[model samples]
Structures are given as structure tokens and as C-alpha cells.
Target: MKQRYHVLLCLLGVIGCLLFFPRDLSSALTFTPQALYDLTASRTGQAAAKPVPFVSSGFAGFLDENGRPQYVEKIRYGAAVSSMGIINYDSVSTKLVMRNRDGEIQVAIETRGYPFFLKERLLIISTDRLRLKEYTTDGDLLWSATFPSPVTACAAAGNRFLIGLLNGNFLYLNEAGEPLYSFTPPEGRIKVAYGAAMDAASEASLVVAGIDPQTAYLLEERNGELNSIESFPLGSDLRRNLLVSSLHGGRFAIEQEQGLLVVDRTNLRRRYFSIPGRLLSVQGHPESNLLSALSQDDSDRFVSMIGSESNYRGRLRLAGYGPGTSILWSGNRFIILVDGHVLVYRLELI
Candidate 1:
């Protein structure tokens, strides 16, 4: 009788404890509603500072971190979206105006060609696209370079910039627009560099160049010199500029066909993830393994949250197809414009 009473008491205690302290059901990756606004509404003005740049509904503007409209204006020619700010061009005056998120004008340059921002530097491409000039953020002309072949692609990180030429050559330039290293991939039948990316990190800065005929070259900058580390053969032809990004876990991602080819930096082992439909853009968390991708599979458009370790998190469906749909991801917030509604979703813990 004593033993039976003791066993019953222990079982009852366990049940009571479980009932009182429940297990945490929080998810590692989830989304919460942050803010939403209708871009169709008449919300126009020069907004406050510290907002993300977006283009929608023939309007270019800045949105706060909370996804609220800061500054909205009717675009004339076109607008270039950058992490720092935006470059709005005036076709009539042939002037390019650069503005920061704080609604402050950084520089205004009058050029016949279109001007785009590469980090803090402004690049003005000639009307024929054969000549390129680099300028400071204050609109001072630094240096000009004319290429015999067409410039296929370009990327900038911090003080460094990479330019890929159609002749299969790639050039790495320093902060003063001086060439640091230049190389051409030998094995490619078509000597063309499709894309290039540089690391913004001060330590162990890496340079990635994607060449035509499906090859990616990796270079590391150390002790003021660049050394070729490794090369990977991508099976598909990169028709457009390569979307290569160095991730958190010593890995990098290259957009190929209907998926992303994620390669390990150490062993050069490759893992492919099918992102469904055509991959538009990829945004990754700097400290974590999370990557967000925007894709338009046929007429259905959505944003997929993916793990760098080949794990599928979830996806959020956006408005249907057309020029009206656009999405941008920054920090933990996702700003999406579907049709005319602008919806913002923040990464949640629950």
C-alpha cells in the first residue's frame, strides 16, 4: 500500500509540473506584421531620413524601416536603387540627382549619359556605353576609363570595385580608381566575364568573378596582393549578370537557371536548391544562414525564406504578375509591393 501511494504521488507531480510550465513553441524563422500602406494613395512629400529606397507605380521614393512612406515622387526617366540611397535622373536636363534616405541631396551631376551609384562612387556611362567615368559622392570627377570592348558587369564593395569586360578580362580597382589586379580566365571558349563581386569586410576580403562558358573564379586579397584560390564550373550559361554573394558560413551562392548553386568555400563542394520559376534576387542575413529569395514562377510571384544549409523555411505570396509587383528586403523587414498595396513583414521570433 505504501509503494502504490508513492508511485501515484510521483506520477501526479510530473503531470502537474508539465501542465504548469509548458514548452516553448517559438519558431526559429517566422514573420510578423510590421506595416502596410497603399502606394496608390496620394502620399507624396520629402520624407524624413533613414529609409529604404523603392520604385513602384511609376513613383520612386524612400520608406522608413517600419515600411512607412518617407518621400514619394514621380519618376522622370528612371531611378537606380542602392543601399545608400537612390539616383533619380532628369531626362530633360540630363542631370542625375543622388539623394540619401534622410531626404538630403548628396550630389547633382549634369551628364548626357545615365549615372548610377556603385557604393559611394557615382559611375557615369556614356551614351554609347563604351566610356565610363568614376566620380566621388560630392560629384567630383575622379578618373575615367574607356574600354575597347563593352563592359558586361560591375560590382562595388566598400572602397573596391570590380569590372568585368566582354573580352573575358576582369579588373579590380582601388579606392583611387587605380588598377590593383587584372586577369582573364583562360579556359573559357568565349572570353567574357558575366559578373563580379567584392567583399566589404576588412579582413579576408574575397573577389569573385564569373566568366562566360560557365566558370566562377575565386580570388583572395591578402597583404595588398590578390591570389587565385579556386575555380568552380557552373553547368549552366550565365545569360545575365551573376548573382554571387559570400555568405556567413564561408560559402557563396550563384544564381543558375531555376535554382541557386551554393558552394562551400573550403572544399568547393556544391549544393543546389531549386527556388521555383525564375530567380529574380537574393538577399541574405549577414550574421545568420538565412537567405531570402524573390521569384516569379509563371504568373505566381512569391518571396521564399531559405536556409543556407539547404533547409526550407517558408514563403509569402505576393500580388500577381505585371510591372506593378516589386519586393525589397533589408535588415529584418521585407517591403513588398503587389498591385498597388505596399506590405511590410518583419522577421518574428514566434
Candidate 2:
């Protein structure tokens, strides 16, 4: 039943791109779309930033800016591809294959775990879920830690990372893997933590915990101590985990029922924006107060840009196929991955 739920949540295929190019730029430049593979048979995956990462059933790799595959490899257990490189683990050999941007084998490490990227660092959660290892992008181990209970959720920013365990313990750790502070949300029927997010500035952190009645808490760090500034009740059931992110301008956003609750941490002001479908991915611009979200309901998909005060700026209708889709905003570039294909757009405002 758990595997069935995973499959149901993963099969969101995108078929076309959002033509967001302005009229003037459309005449001066041409935007081309590329299909890297046929992912109709593929089950679950996601996309990352530049040299975008694409993963299907048994294959994984990264694509260059032009939507061309830089490297592609077959895998068995798990794979984590970032703008930095690729980390693939083969259970049979009990080894990890690390590759560079150009698909060159840089190094190989022996480990049995699921490799993933946390912010700019590489981390692997042990198969037993009791241990965590952080490694540099080059496949060198930086630090590792053991937890008394299973790690249920994690998030990272700037130089700090937060890890939440099944026992309701949340540990805030610095770059050296040293714990700075620990917290546990007060009162809950079930203690499991579902998700967490922290901004790059380390000013605020968000966590959603419990089962029967999940709750979202916004926390502030001051004088080396973490304090809960606000708390909100969340829906009892969720198809996807909470979409919690620390946005620009001292603001944070949380995915509520059918809209997003945007709050300013400094003044405790709030705004809400209603999204049309199942929210897939959200990316916030670091330099500006621009927020982009991707959503899909059945065969209809959309990419919307939001400004301050939950103001709707613009939206583009996207068409696509398969079982998964995601969006990433880096500077003025908007990247969308549908099924197994990658589409990148360079936006210029007039």
C-alpha cells in the first residue's frame, strides 16, 4: 500500500512547455525544447538547478544548459545528481560512482545508502536510517553522525542544517556537523515530523510535525537559542508533504489547504495566495522578492510568478506527459522538467 501511494503521487507527466518569451525577444531569439527520453514507462523522479538533473526508473544523469544530456548511466539502488556531479550507488558492488559535470569518473566510494543533495553538500542516509553522512561535492566524507532514532526529515541553508528524528527531536547543526541547538515541538498525538525548511540566512526555520493533527511552527533563532514565534494548525491529511520555504525579504511560505500562507517573520504579517492545482515545486529568487510555483491538475499544468503581498504577476499554461514534473528558478532563468525531458527559458523583462 505504501508503494502504491508512492506511485500515485509520482505519476504527473508534463507534455509541453510554457511559452513565456516576450513578443520582442521572440523575434530576436529562438527558444528550442528538447526531449531527453520517453518517461511514460518511468515511475518517479524530480529536477534540480543548472546542468539539470533527470532520473527515471533505472537511469539518471544531468543535462547542460541547452537541454542536452551531459552524462547518462544505468543504476541499481539509488542516484543523486546535482549541478556539481552525479552520485550513483550499485547495491551489487556496494560502491558509489561519482562523476563530474562532463561525465568523467572522479572517484568511487563504498557505501550502502541512499545518496541525496542537501543544499550544496552531498549527504547519504544510511539504509537503517540511524546514521547520516555528509560529504563534499567531490565524494570526500566531511562528517557523519548517528541518531538514536530514525531521521524522518531534514533541511539545509547557508552554513546550518536541521535534522528531525522519529523521536520528535530536531537538531540544528552547523557546517562542522556540531549541534548548535535542539528542539522538539510541544504536544502532539504522534511525534513523527513530516518536513522542515530553513532559510539561507539562518534567521528562521519551519517544521511540520504529528500525524492525527499536523501542526506547522515558525521558529526564530536568537542568542544561540531557538524559539517558536508562531504556530498554525494544518489539515489532518495530506497527499504530499508540506511545501515550506523561507522566501526573500524576511518572509516564509507554507502550503495550506489549497493556497499558500506567506508570512513576514519580522512583523508577523501574513498573506495568502490560492494555487490552481496540486503544487509540484516552488522556487524563490534570492536577489528579488519573486516567487515561482508549478502546479498540475490532471492534464492541465501551469507556472505562475508571484510578487509581494500575494499579488499575482503572471502565469503560463504548460502541457506535458508522464508521472513527474518540477521547476527551478536561478537568476533570470526558468527551468522545467517534464517526464524525462528538460526545458529551459531565459527571461528578460521589458
Candidate 3:
């Protein structure tokens, strides 16, 4: 009986080693909410700088460094921003040129007739209705033209502008808006266009996501030819209300009916996670691989920052992923940018 008891004890020791030893050995780490909150708070006290304002209808206006309103001048039609921050406007000209921060006129060429801004690129919708027009940053029109269908969305990717259209078409244009190469997508699929990016590892290659009747296609550009690298069907929940926001490099974030999905553009692998509360607004960082979402909890509002894979793991494992999310910043200062004017919030986060 003593010998039997010894054997049982040995077995229990082995089981404990298997269960607990590996976790300690792996050195897995996580982030704490307190740390994150502290980091964000530190950024707040450092004198708020006024952001450039582009105002239109309602209360659409930007604030200067002194908190003065800077309204968009000569606004003929109301402009709408896409989920990815693309601004779309309706006008008669085919070729439109607008000034940038450097005071240089950046020309936008449209094949179809649509005049829209994607990222920083002004896209011409249809080639048939193409018209050329020059404008100053102060909304002065210097020149105007009419062009044709197959209008494309343009965005500033690195140094060059990537132009894409609805019909699986693409083009690379210089800063002067001169076309470098015309790109065509594969058969039977329409290029979503908004989520295109240049591969981080290879600037010569481009990554773009498109959708067919049933599946999403992730394609890679090699020497101008688009090769299908990954494809997957949209989740049933996502398919119901598929709204894609920002696409970073090869990864894209989408707001689905179920929650948010972060997809790897190269291999089509994905990670699915959801915020506890309803998402009010979402934005992506331009230089970093992070996503910040604004959500409201009960009566309070909060900002949640989800960094890259490493930052996410750090937060979840170390700090403990809790209800809702780790509040990055919150205040009763309800400020909602809708239809132009900033709607103030009555709730405050103490």
C-alpha cells in the first residue's frame, strides 16, 4: 500500500509539470489597462494643437491652432467621406486639380465622371464624362475638361498615387497626376479599390482585396500582373452588413454585423474580435499598425486602442481583457462630427 501511494504521487507531479511548466517557460506577456490609460493621459496634458478644418454643410469646419474655425471655401456640393476617409464630391469637370499643404496643384484624372477623394487622391469616376479643371487651395478654379466611364479612386501610397476603379482597373500616377502604368484585375471579380496597399516587404508589389459574387480575393501585384494569393467567403454575419474601414499594408479591418474582423491581406488569415459596446467611430493610424475605436458603454464613452499583434497580446495577457475594453480616453465632452458641426456630449469620465 505504501508503494502504491508513492506511484500515485509521482503521476500527480507529472501532470502538474505538463500543465504549468510550459506557460512559465514561454514568457508570454500582456498589457495592463492602467498602463495604457496612463500612457494616453500623458499625451492629453501636452497642449492640444488645433487640427486643420474642412467645413461644408451644417457645422462642417476645422479648427485652427487657436481654436478658430477654418471653413472650406466655395463649396458647391456637400462632400461625404468614405469609411477610409475618402472624400467624394459632385462637379462637372473631368480633370480636377486641388492644392496640397505644399501649395502645389495636385491633378486628379477621372475616366468615368465621378469626382471623389480617396485617402488624399481625388478620383475621377467616369472616363466618358472626363473634364479637366484647375483649382487653388482656396477653391479657385483655374482650368476645367470632360472625360469618359470606369472612374477610379486615388490614394497616396508612399510617394506615388494608386488609382483604382469599380471595374477591376488600376493605375499608378506620379505626384503630378501623370499615369505611369495601367493595371487590370482578374476576370470575374470587381476590385473593391478602397483597401489597396503596397507590400511592406516589396514596394514593387501591390496588395489589393476584391470581392466576387461569393468570395473575397486578396491579390498581389508582381511586375504588373495580379496573382491571387488568398480568397475566403465573407462570414455570414459580416455578409449581411459588410462595411470595411481602413486597410493597412496587407491587413484590413472591417465592421461586420457580428463584430470587427482583421484580415491578413497576404494569406487571407483573419482574427475575429468584438467590442462589448456599440462602436461609434473607428480610425486607423497612418504610420503604425494600430486601430482606435470609439465606443459608448452604458452612459459613458471611451476610446479603445488595438495595436498590432504584439500590442494586442500584451494587453490581453498581461493586463487582463475585461468587459468592454481598456479605456484609453474618456470624457463627458461628447463631441460627435456629424453633418459638419461637432455635437457636444453631456457625459464626462471622471
Q: In model 3, how large is the Cα lDDT of residue 325?
A: 27
**Ten-residue segment with the worst summed lDDT in candidate 2?**
12-21
TM-scores for the candidates = 0.81, 0.77, 0.47
Candidate 1: which stretches are off by over 4 Å? 1-26, 44-46, 82-85, 90-93, 99-107, 202-212, 246-250, 264-269
Which of candidates 1 and 2 reaches a greater TM-score? 1
lDDT of 1 by residue, 126-194 (tens): 777677888777778888877777887777776777777777787877777788878777666667677
The true-versus-predicted C-alpha distance at residue 158 of model 1, in Å, is 2.9
Which of 2 and 3 is the better model by lDDT? Answer: 2
Scored by Cα lDDT, where does model 2 land? Answer: 0.69
Candidate 2's residue-wise lDDT over 93-186, tens digit each? 4677778766678777777788888775888889888999988756688899888899888899888989988887789988988889988877
Worst 10 residues of 3 by lDDT: 33-42
Instruction: Give the per-residue Cα lDDT of candidate 3 at 201.
Output: 36
The alpha-carbon lDDT assigned to residue 90 of candidate 2 equals 63
Candidates 1 and 2 compared by lDDT, better number: 2
Quantify all predictions' global Cα lDDT against the true fold. Answer: 0.68, 0.69, 0.41
For model 3, the superposed segments whose C-alpha errors exceed 4 Å read 1-50, 54-57, 64-76, 80-148, 174-215, 219-229, 236-250, 255-258, 265-269, 274-281, 285-290, 293-335, 338-350
